[model samples]
Target chain A: MKKLTKDDLQAIKQEELKKETANWIKVGLSTCGIAAGAQDIYDFLVEEVKKRNLGVSIQRCGCAGMCYAEPLIEVKVEGMPKVFYGKVNKETAMKIVEKHIGGKILVNDHIYDIRSSQ
Target chain B: MQQKRILIKDTDLKKDRTRDFYTAFLTEIQDKKLEEKVQLVRVSDIGIYGKGLTVRVLPENFLYCDVETGDISRIVSESVVEGRPIEALLHKPDDKQLRLVLRNCGLVDPESIDDYIKHDGYQAIATILEKMTPEKVIEEMKISELRGRGGAGFPTWLKWKLTRAVEADQKYVICNGDEGDPGAYMDRSVLEGDPHSVIEGMMIAAYVIGATKGFFYIRAEYPLAIERVNRAVTQAHEYGLLGENILGSSFKLDIEIRLGAGAFVCGEETALISSVEGKRGYPRPRPPYPSVKGLWGKPTVINNVETLANIPLIMLKGGKWFSSIGTEKSKGSKVFALTGKVKNSGLIEVPMGTTLKEIVFEIGGGGIAGKKVKAVQTGGPSGGVIPEDFINAPVGYESLQKLGSIMGSGGMIVMNEDDCMVDIAKFYLRFCVDESCGKCAPCRIGGTQLLHLLEKISEGKGEIEDLDRLRRISRAMQKAALCGLGQTAPNPVLSTLRYFEDEYKAHIVEKKCPAGRCAGLFHFSIIEEKCKRCGLCFRNCPVQAVSGNRDQGYLIFEEKCINCGRCFEVCKFEAVSRG
Candidate 1:
C-alpha cells in the first residue's frame, strides 16, 4: 500500500461515508450505552435483520451524549423521517424491525428524537 | 418536492411561549389552508438562548430571531410557505462548538483500526518518529500550553520536561483513566468512543519521554471502556504501533491495561501510583512529584485520558492554532459531563470561558422538567456549588477556583430548586468520606468528623457550634492532608457553607429544610382542604403511616411516618404537603 496524502485520506473518508445512506440502524456501543443494555439490543437487531433479510444496514457508533436514555437506536430510511429510539431493549429492537423496517411505520413511545425531511 | 422547512423556537429562557407560537403557526396554516404544503412540528430543543422567538429555516438554513406573532405571517409568506428569508428578522453567524479532544468520538468505529487510520490518526506518531525529535515535541507542547484536563491544570509540557530531564534507563507514561467524579463520564466516553486517540497520545508521550512501557489505569466500573481499550491496544500492537519498532521506527513502547477497583482516592497521582504498584491506594507527600520520582522510584508522566486524546491534534495542527481557541489562561476545549437536573444530561465540549449559564441553560436545555435552576456543582466531591446568580461566571480553571470550586475533571452537575444546599453539601462530603483511603489522620478522621456533623445537621440534631467545628476541621484537612484527595475533599462542604450559611442556620434553629430534602427536618402532612376524601395516600404509604378513614380524610401519623414522601408522590390531588 502506498502512503496517502491528506487530500486522498479525506476523499476516502467522504467516499466511505457516502455508502451509509437510506435505511440504516445505528446502535450506541459506548460504555454508557452498553451499560444500559445496548449490546443485547445490538445483537437482537442484527439477528432480526438477518432472519428477515431486511433492507436495513445495521451499524454501530459512539454515544450521542444522552446517557440517561441509553440503549439508543438511530434509524434512518429514505422518504421516512430519521428517528432515535431510546431505552430500547430486545423487545423494542424486534418492534423497531417489525414496525419501522417491515411495516414502514414509525414506532410510538420509544421515539425520543425525530428528524423529518421536508 | 418541498424545498423549505421552518424550525420555530421561543428563545426566551424566562418562560416557554413556544406552545403559543406553535398554536399561532398552526392556526395561520389552517386559516391560509396551507396544511398540505407546509408542515409544522413542536421540537424538544433548539440550540439558541434568551433571544425571543427564534425560527430557523432549513435547506437554506436561514435563522430568524426575536420573531413575533405578527411577523409569523411574513415568515410564512417569505420564508416558510415561499422560500426566502425575511431580511429584517434574519440572524446570521452562529459560532459552533469546536471539538478537538472529542473529534473522533461518535464519528469513528472504535473496534476498527483501519477506520482510525483512515482518519489520519496514528500519522502524527509516524511523523514524530520520522521527523521531530523528543526536544521538539516537548517544545511544541510548551507552545500549545496544554494543561492536564484531569484537574489542577498543571502544564503538560513541564511534566514531560521533568521526566525527560531525569537520567534513567527506564521511564514510564501512564494514562489516568480512573475517572470516579460524580456525574463525570468524559474520560469514559473518550476511552470507549475513540480509544485510538488516547492510544495515539500515549505513543506520542512515549516518543517524547523515551518510555519503553505505558499503562492505562481505567476503573473496573467501565467494562465497555476497558474492553474497547484492550481491543485498541491489541490492534495497535498488531499494526506495529506498539511493541518493537512502532510504526516502522526504532522507537519501541509496550502498553498494558490495568483496571482500578473504583476507589475515588486512587484518582489522586500518588495514590494511583501506589495502587498500580500493588500497595494500598494512599496518597504520599509531593515535591518528589511523579514527574521526578514516580512509579517504583522511576520518573513517570501520567496524563489523563482526555489530556492524552488532545496530543495527536496538538501535534498535527500548529500549537498556536490549538492555543487560540480558548481563553487567555485556559487553552483548547474542555469536555464536560453535564448531568444532574438538566434536560439534556450528557457530554458537552465547550471552549474555555464559555459561561456556565450557556453550558447549562443553552447547551443542556436548562433544568429538568422546566424547573428553575438553583445552582451548578462542578468538580464533583472536590468542587463547590455555584449559585444561580453566578451562572454567568466563565468556566475555566481560575474562574471556578475563585468561586470556591476547582475545575476537577469537568463534571458540571446542574442543580434545580428542589435540591437543598445543606443536603447537597452532605452528599459530596459523605462521598469523600466513603472514598477516603484512611492512610492519613487528617483525611480519614477529619472527613469522617465533618460528614458526621453534616449528617447531624441534615437529621435535625445540629447546633450552631457544629458550624465552627466544620470550619476548624476543614482548615486542618486543607493544611495537613497528604495529597489532592484529602486537601480538596472538604471543598463542597466549605464552599456551600460559605455561600448558603443561612440554610445551615435554618436547619439548626428553625428545624426546617427549605428545599424539603432533609428527611428529619421535613414534615409531611395532608392538607384537609385539598384532600378529596380519597384513600390514595393511605394505600400508597409504604409503612401504612397515613392512618384515617376516607370520610375524615387521611392524616400522617408523626411517630410512624418515615418521611419517605411516598404519599406525596401518590396523591394526585395535591393533598399531601411537605415542609
Candidate 2:
C-alpha cells in the first residue's frame, strides 16, 4: 500500500489487467441490485463454485442500470458469449453454473441483455 | 463447424409469441439437424420494441425484425445455418444512446481503485498535475461547454472561474451529491457504482481552483453510496491523490464527507453550503453566490455528481472532442434515471439533446404494460412535465426549458395515459410543500396556497377562478420566494396548466376527471355484460359496496362506492368500470 506516483499507475493497471487467469462472474452488488436479491445469487454462485471445485471466480460490481431484471449477473465463461442474466435467483444461479459454465451452452429465457455495445 | 447463435424475442406488447416462435425455430433447426452447431436462445428482451418479432443472429451481428413463421426457415438457413444474412429482412436499428459519464459505472467495481485505474480513472488528475495550468483547466471546461447537470444548467467552467478569480487563501470545493428530487437516483447510482471517477473529477476541480479542502455532500439516505465514497476517499488519500502533495505535485488537497440530513432544499447550492457548515438547510438570496463566498466565507466551487463524473473524461479526452457530441448549447452526454411506467426502468445515458421520444421508446423500450405514454415528467418537483406531443423536443437545458421543463437532475419519469395531469401537478406541489424550509412567506404561504388550490381542483370543488388564482400564486412564488425551492415549486403546476389547461377546465367546469385519477370526481359502476360474476370485484371491495354474490352477480352501489378502483384492478372480466 505505497503512495502511487504517476509512473506507477500504468504499470499497476497493466499488471491488474493481465492478472485475469480464470473465468469470472460479476454480480451487480449496488443498492438496486442488492434490493433485487443479487446478494443471494452472489453467495450461491460462490458456494456452488467452491462445492463443485470450479475454476470460476465470483466478484461484485455495481448496477448496470437495467434494474427491472435484477438480481442481475454477468457470466464470462470461456468460449461463451458474455451476457447478462436478469431476474436471477438461486435456481437460475445453479442453472447458469451447470449450463453456461459446465455445459458451454447459454441457458434459455434467462438472458436479459447481451453486451452488444462492447 | 463454426458455432452460430440466434437471439429471439417477441416485441409485441399484447401477446408473447416467443414460445410459438421458439418452437418453430427449434423445429426448423431440428429439420436441418443443426441443433448443436446452431444454438437458438429465447431472450427476455432483445432491446427492440414494437417492431413485431426480432431475431438477432450472432457472430455476424445481423438483425431481422418483423420475422413471420414462414420467414423463420429462411432466417435459419441463411443467417443461422449458412452464416449469410437475408438482405431484405436485415433491419438496421438506430441506437441513440451513448454512455460517457456512466462508462465505468456498473462495469468497474466501485470499491476497487485498481479497477477504476485500469479503466483510465485518475489519469485526468495525473495529467492535470503534470501539465495543465488552472486557467488551462478552466479553458478546457469552457470548451466542453458542460453546464451543471444539477437542474439549473449553470456552466461548470464559469463557476470555477468565478471561484478562482476570488483571491482567498482557504478555498473549498464541494461535490453536490444531495440529490433530493423524487424519482431521481442518478447521483446515488453514480456515487455507488463509480466512486473513484467522481473523486477524480473533484481532484481535477481542486487542482483547477487551487482549493486545499473539499467536501463530498451525500444525503444520509444513500448508505451504500456513503460507504463506497468513504472507501474511495480513503483509497485516494492512501495513493497520494488527496491530503497533501497529490500526485507528487506541489498542490495539496484533502477531501472529507459531510452527510445531509435528508432535506430537499440542501440540493440548492447556498443551502448545501449552509448544511455543510452544520446549519439548517435554508437557502439564502444570491448576491454572493457560492462561487464568490462559499463554505465558511471562503471562495468555493460546488459541482453536481454527474457534472463531476464528466470532468475526468473531459480532462482525459480533449474538450473539443467532448463538445462534438451534444447540441450547440448543451454538450457531452446526460444520464437519466428512467423510471415510472417505463418497461425497462433503469439508468440510461444518452448524448445531450437526444429527443425524449428516443429515450422512452428506443432506450427505455416504451411505456410499461401495454399502456400508451401520455406525458414524460422531467426535472422532478422543481421542473415541469413534457406532454406526449413535445417528447420529440431535444432534451437540453434550453430545449427542455422551452418545452416548459428543465433537465433537473436527469429524473425522467415516463407517465402513462392513466396518470392525471392535475394529479401529477398536485403530487409535485405536495412534495415541494412538505420539503419547503418555510424561510420565506411567498414560498412558505404561496406553496401551501397553490397546493390547496390544486387539492380543490382534484376534489371537484374548484371554480374557474381558482385556475387564475393558481397562476397568480405560482407567479408570486417564482418571483418573491427566497430560493430555488419556492421559485421553481410552481413549475409543475404552471407547465401542466399551460399544456393541459383543457384538462384543468374539465376538472373545474365539467366536474369530471378526464383521466379518472381523482377519486372524488369519479364513481364505480359495473357493466352487467362484462361482469362474469366471479366475485373477484366483490371480494376485493374494501367496504361492503356490492351486496350480490356469485349467483346473483355483483353490483357496485353508487352510494357505498369509495371510487378506490380496487375492484377495477381485481376484475379479470373488465366488469368493474369507473367514470
Candidate 3:
C-alpha cells in the first residue's frame, strides 16, 4: 500500500462505504469472548458457511460489555431484525444458522440482546 | 407483511415469573387470535431489575414494567394490536449508559484499518492536521473539558499546555497502558478492541503539545493488547499518519512501544517515565512533574490509555459536544472494567453522573449467584468501597472522592454479602505492599503496618485499638507517600474501616467472620443429618482430615485441618457447615 495523503483517506473511506454487504455475522473475538470459546464458534461458523455456500459474511469484533453472555454472535439478515445471541457453542451456532439465517426466525433461549444498528 | 415482537423477562428477585407471565401472555394472545401478529420472546436479560415481570413491545418501543396477568390483554390490544401504549402500564426507562468513547468498541473489526476508517477513524487526525493549529487544538481540548481518565482526573488541556509552555529541546508523549489493577482490564480491552483510536489520540496529542516522539508504556501481561498496538502503529506509519511530515503537513511525529516489567508502581506517571527511560521503576518526588521534567530530562506528557482513547472522538465531534456528556466537574464518558460478583462483568462506558445502582443492576444485570450486593469497590486498591446503601449516589470524580474514593482508572468491582470488608481491604493492601518500591518511609512502613493490622483483624486476633492504628498509618501514608500508588494504597483500608467498622468489631469482640470468608475465624464441621456418607469429604481432604467409611459416616478432624476449606468444597451434600 502506498503512503496515504489526505485525498487518499477520503477515497478509501468512500470505497469502503460503497462495498456491497447484504448479510453478515459478527462474533465478539475480544479476550472475554475468546476465553468463552469464541474461536471454536468462529471456526465452526466459517466452516459451515463455506460448506453450505451461504451468502453471509463472518467478521470478528471486540467485547460489547456483556461478559455474562460470552461467545456473543450478532447476526444480520436482509429482512429480519439484527439479533445478538450469547453463550454460543457449535450446536447453538448451527441452530443460529438454520433458524436465524435460513428459516428467518430468531433463536429462542440464546438471545441476550436485540437491537438494530441499521 | 406485519411483524411485531415482545421481549419479556422477570426482574423480580423473589421468584422467576418470566415463564408464568410468558404462558399467560401467550394464552391471551391466542385468545385474541393475534398469535401471527405478535411474536413473544423470553429474553434472558431485559436490562431492567426489580420491576417484576417486564414487557417490552418492539418497533413501537413501548415498555411495560411490573406487568400482571391482567395487563397482558391490554398490552396485546393497546401496544401489540393497536400499535399504541396503555397509560396504566407504560414505563419510561431512564437509560443511564451513553456510549461515546466506546462507540466503535464492539461494532468494528478491530484488526482492519479500513473497517475503522469506515466508522470515521483517522478522520479526526486527518482534519486536525489539515485545518487546526497547535493553539487551536489545545483550545478545543480545553473547551471539551476532558479530564484524565487515569484516576486523578487531571485536566488534559492543562497537562498539554504545561508541556507546551516549557521550551525544551525535545518533547515526548506517552500513552500509559500499564493497567495493573487486580480486577481492571479496561485499558487492555480498549487497546485490543480499538488500538487505532489510541494511536490517533496520541497523534492529536502530539500535534497539540508539539511532541515529535511518543511511546506506549503497556504492561507485558497484555500480550494481545501489545500486539494490536504494535500493529496499529505500523498501520498508521504505512498510512503516512505517523512518520515525518504526517498527512502532507510540516509537523512530524513518531511513536514507539515500550513493555512494562509488570510493576504496579509504573502505572504512576513519574514511575512510568523512569521505566520508559530504561531505569528501575521507582517514583521520585514531584515538584518538577513529568510534564515539566520527564523521559531523560526532557518535557513529556503522559496520558492514560482511556484518556488518549477519548481524543479522536473529542476532536471529531468538537470539544463542546464532548463536554456535554458528563457531570459538572467530570466531562465525557468513562469506561469501567466492571468485574467481581457482577453478573455482566465486562467493560461498561457510561456518562459521569450515572448512579452506582444503574451501572451495577441495569448494565451489570445485577449480582451473580443470587447473592445480595454488599458494596461496589471502585479504583482498585487506591479506591474506597461504596456501601450498598450509597449505591444510588452519582459517579463522578469529585463525588467518588467525597465518598473516600477516587475514580481510579475505572476499575469497579461489585462486591457481595459474602465478601468480608476486612478481607477485601486486606487483599488490596497486600497488592500495594508487594508493589511498593520502598522509596519513602510512610508508604513502605505504613502499607506494611496497615496490611498487618488487616491480617490481624481477619484472623480474629484484632483489638479495637488496631482499628485506630490503621487509621493513623493510613493518614500518614496518604500525606507522605512519594507517588500516587503509595498515596492511594490506604484508601481501601480507610474506606472499609469507615463503612464496615461493625464487621471489624464483630471480628474483634466476637471472634467471628460474619461473611465466613476468614477461615481462621470460622470453623467448619459436618452436619450429621445433612451428611450423605458419600465419602467425598474423606477422599478430597488435602490434609487427610476427613475420616471414616461411607456406612460409618465421615468426620472432619479439626486438629489436622489447616482451614483451607477443601472438604467443604468437595461435600456433595450440604453437610459442611461453617459459622
The number of the candidate with the highest TM-score is 2
lDDT of 2 by residue, B65-170 (tens): 9989999888877777677889998899876778888888778989898888889978888888899899999999999999999988899999899888889889
Candidate 1 chain B weakest lDDT stretch, 10 residues? B38-47
lDDT of 2 at B75: 86
lDDT of 1: 0.84
TM-scores for candidates 1 onward, in order: 0.89, 0.98, 0.95
Model 3 stretches astray by more than 4 angstroms: B13-16, B27-38, B527-544, B549-553, B564-576
Residue pairs in clash, model 1: none
Better of 1 and 3 by TM-score: 3
TM-score for chain A as predicted in candidate 3 = 0.94
Candidate 3 chain B, poorest ten consecutive residues by summed lDDT: B12-21
Query: Model 2, residue B313: displacement in angstroms?
Result: 0.4
Please give the clash total of every predicted structure, in order: 0, 0, 0
lDDT of 3 by residue, B145-194 (tens): 99999988899999999999999889999999999988898888888888
Q: What does DockQ give for each predicted structure?
A: 0.31, 0.68, 0.66
Which portions of model 2 show Cα errors greater than 4 Å?
A116-118, B13-16, B557-560
- How far residue B303's Cα lies from its native spot in candidate 1, in Å, is 0.6
